[model samples]
Target chain A: MKENNSFILGIKHGIPICLGYLSVSFAFGIFAVGSGLSVIEALLISMFNLTSAGQLAAVPIITGGGGIPELALAQLIINLRYSLMSVTLSQKLGKTVSALDRFWIGFGITDEIFAVSTSKNKSVGRKYMFGLILTPYAGWSLGTLLGSVAGNILPDSVSSALGIAIYGMFIAIVLPTVKKHLPTALCVVGAIAIGCAFKYIPMLSRVPDGFVIIIAAVVASMVAALLSPVSDEESEQTDEKEVNTDA
Target chain B: MPSMNFFFHLGVMAGITYLVRMLPLVLVNKKIRNRFLLSFLYYVPYAVLSVMTVPAIFYATSSPWSALAGFVIAMILAFFEKSLLTVAIFSSAAVFVTEFLLPIIQ
Candidate 1:
């Protein structure tokens, strides 16, 4: 009964993620089809990969006649955050979780999934994670299929307008956190400075987009973490407990 | 006009993508606890996001000057803690208007 309740909670929590994924994946599908991919091909890509940024980045590389190595490197750099997310989540899951469960859960470690999962109380278990993954996975895959089929039906202007949705989503993700954390605000400024420098400086401008992103992220994160060290007293208080399971 | 090769290319892309996604999971041991590493990991997403979004403020526009105007509008909206949807629409509209009106005025 407890397991069933956890599973239900997972599904309920996944609702917002599913809705967001549907809209974004639909846009991606339309863009992919507009870029000359067929419906099946687009749907297949979204289904298997489920990474909007990587997909967007890959689309241009593929179309621009970039080689396989270029595509792989671009994707590696763009989605490297997933590696961090996976590691943090594994620690959160702890010892009792089976290997097979970890395998399946690892597959669903997208930004939204990690956000929702980590935000949950420690009491939440693998069942809940599985349920959360199910709905968004379906929404993303199906939305891509639908959008691919519906491509070119909409006016180019409207399609171009919809291009802002992903940016809107990014703003939604970052703004709230930045408002609460001064370090985050500093990181944002640092990123802007670094990005602008890369764009304008002749030496940095020669660097590839993927490499630039990786470098900027690493440097900004390092600086932010260094400048705002967490207080040891607060860390000690939190570390005393195994996991705060209270929701 | 997607050719059969398109599907083949996508398949290759998917394979490569999955390999990248699966690597850290297979490699990173769950028991390892490095405070410095964890702290670094915590801020990565935010840094990556800022890096990605900051450039788009300029790249999305037709000209750098016009994009700067739009970016100013965005920064103002962001400073005031405006809604994301509102900020996005306002910033893009600012760019569109700037791009549209600048030539006429000049």
Candidate 2:
């Protein structure tokens, strides 16, 4: 019964994430193909990367004949947050999960997946985690393939409108959290300040956009964590109950 | 058909991406037992989201003045806890109208 509940919860949580992934991946697919990649190549990239920003950043670089080192560096810088996320999620998994399960779970760790999974009860089992990953994984890949193929047929106006969907999904994720958390509010201000600073500062404005996000995330998270540590009581109250129903 | 170069590039990207994502899960699964680290992870998503979103509100426009108008409108709507879809649409619309009408009126 407990297992069933977790499975259901995973599916439920995946719904909004899947919707967002579809729209975003669709746009990515269209843009990628339009940028000169074939439909199959676009599909494969989206399937493996499953990251919007990382792929978007790579598109121009790849098309421009940027070296492998440059592409790898850009992806690494943009995706460094996943390392922090994996460390946190590791604790939530406790000591029960096997290395194999962790392997699969890590493959699905996108910004959306990390956000949704981390927001859930910590004692969630590997089975549910699998469910969450599987649904969105399919949605994102399929959306990419379809969008890439559709790019040839779709009108330019429609494709451009779909491009905006990714930004809309991003805003959706941020708004609800800022409404609830003061530290989050501070982080938002810090991010905007950092973004503006990077844009306007004489030397900084020349840095790549992907690096800016990584720098902003690390600086803002560190500052917010230092300024407002999570209280012991709140942590305890939010402690997820571990139900060992697998046996 | 896609060029061989495109396929090779795509394959390289896929390999690199999978490694970055998979490395932490494998490494940390064996070593991480710190409670402080766990708490830090809990807040990372919100921080990352904010970092990604706030800049878009301003950068969505072509000109500084138009972006300023969009930012003002977006902030007001966001303060009221409007849906992000609503805020983005209204703000983009605000930029378009402001930029479009400014010229006509002037």
Candidate 3:
């Protein structure tokens, strides 16, 4: 009964994540198809790779016939942050959570899951974490499937317009926190400025989009972390713990 | 797209990404008490999302102008802390309308 309740709780909390992913992944689906992935390919991509940044970023590179190493490298850099989240969450799960549950649940620990799970002052159990990840997982997959199918049907002009959906989703995820937090706000501006520099500067322009994202994220984040290291007490809410920006 | 290469990339991307998550979860059984690393990890999401949004967004629309309009619309919605889906839908709709109206005016 308790497991079921937490499962339900996870779904309840995950509803917004599901809803948001449905549209953002819709954009990804269309973007994937627009970039030449088959509908099934797009769906599978969403299924296999749940996060938005790496999967969506990989599409252009993959479609352009980039190599396995390039794709692997992109996944590593983009998703590496999750490692920190996983470690953070692992402590929350604690010794009570079995090794088996820990392994499986880690798969679901995206930004939102981490944020929501960590937000609980009490330690989170296996069931709650599983429950939390479920809705967003379904939402992500379902949205991608729909988007892939829709991509085949939508006209180019409209599909092109829809392309902004992914970025819009990113903005919605980050903008609120950036507004509330000065360090986070600086981090956004700094990342964008670096990203733009890579694009316009002649020498840096040759860098692949994948490399550029990795470099910008790492460098800007490192700087911000130095400038504004959170006291240990304020860290949990500072997440990262959501699709709220967690995923 | 060649099936062989596609699957290869998929396998590698999924494999490495999974390892990234799994290692930390399974291995790091103890809680991190370190302030410095904790602070750094906290900033990761904001940085990642920010870098991912730009340059690429410019090309997601029929025109850069349309994308910019959508971005502006999204920023406004997000500033007021609207739901994610609301921000995305409204912004995309804004982009679609801008795209549609542009050719007529131009």
Better of 2 and 3 by DockQ: 3
- The CAPRI category of model 1 is acceptable
lDDT of 1 by residue, A80-114 (tens): 76776676566566444577677677678787677
Ranking by lDDT: 3, 1, 2
Judge candidate 1 at residue B30 and give its lDDT: 68
- The prediction achieving the highest TM-score against the true structure is 3
Per-residue accuracy of model 3 over A1-247 as CA lDDT, tens digit each? 1222366777788887677677778888988888899988898788887888889779978888766666777788788878888887776774447888877887787776677777666677766777788888998998888888888898877787777888887888788888888888898899999999999999999888877787888888889888888876556555542345423
Candidate 1 residue A221 Cα shift, in angstroms, is: 2.1
Chain A TM-scores of each predicted structure, in the order given, are 0.76, 0.70, 0.87
RMSD (CA, Å), candidate 1 to true, equals 5.5
Model 1 scores a C-alpha lDDT of: 0.66
Sum up the clashes in candidate 1. Answer: 0
Question: Which residue pairs come into collision in candidate 2?
Answer: none
Candidates 1 and 3 compared: the better one by lDDT is: 3
lDDT of 1 at B103: 90
Q: Summarize candidate 3's per-residue lDDT along B65-102 as a digit string, tens digits.
A: 89889989999998987877788889989998998999
Candidate 2, position B70, lDDT: 65
Put down candidate 2 lDDT per residue, B9-78, tens digits, no spaces.
6777766777777787777646444545544554555555555556654544346566667666666776
Which candidate gets the maximum lDDT versus the true structure?
3
